[model samples]
Target: MTIKPFQVQNMLRHYGQHLDQGRRMARYRMLLQRASPEDVVNLSQDGRRKQLVEKIAAEIMDSLMVSGSSNPVVLEIKEELEREFGFGMEFRYLPLEPELQILRKEGEELTEVVGEEKQTILQRFWRITLAKVNETML
Candidate 1:
């Protein structure tokens, strides 16, 4: 099944949170800052360095979320997930509807809205899980 843009975004968010829970932001930053132009250029020449670059990129994307920049992180995460899962994913931004705003202001009644969001997120998680399975089969 084709993954929806929103689903990919949700996966990126979940992965970012997972990285934060691991407290690996500092290490990730150090790696990125220390990576030389030559190191980056030579990454294709060395499998280990290539893997390191991928890991660093993932971590940097996660760290960016901590810095209050979620867009770039979301983009990188979507790309990485597509690469790792071998599935096509895209992102599109649409303005939030007025109903959503009203729901947000509903306080306790917002539970229903929150529950719907959570359910959507869970559906995205399942898609990612299936993507992983599909990748393994290939």
Candidate 2:
């Protein structure tokens, strides 16, 4: 799960030269729409799935820094997320975080509204829970 500010900082710091700021942002939005919100990862137990997701997040940020955009790499990572830990994968459009909420110069709110009100909680950031390996399966 994303810890909001830290991840956003990574994106800004790791902006790519290839995708251009607009395209990179577009892709980022797209991915987030397809991901789940995770504020903290539980690593005391099975942590492999969380590690995999974190790896993908880091690589995508790194790729943007190095390769501008790597759609193939992103897609491959998505596939792996589903293939290995299908049980916990989730996707949905999420509301903007408090940090993203802003009053525009035009006296309008920058936060996107859904239906009539903004979503109160964002549970849409991508995260994973590694399943315990059962002896029977082993």
lDDT of 2 by residue, 1-138 (tens): 657998887785555332344454676798778877674455653466556655565444333323423465444543454465332222212233212221112234243334322222111212221121121122
Q: Which candidate has the top score in TM-score?
A: 1
Model 1 residue runs over 4 Å out of place are 1-22, 25-44, 70-138
Off by over 4 Å in 2: 1-70, 87-93, 98-138
lDDT of each: 0.45, 0.39
Q: What is the lDDT of candidate 2?
A: 0.39
Q: How close is candidate 2 to the true structure, as a TM-score?
A: 0.22
- Give the winner by lDDT: 1
Give the per-residue Cα lDDT of candidate 1 at 24. Answer: 60
TM-score against native, each model:
0.23, 0.22
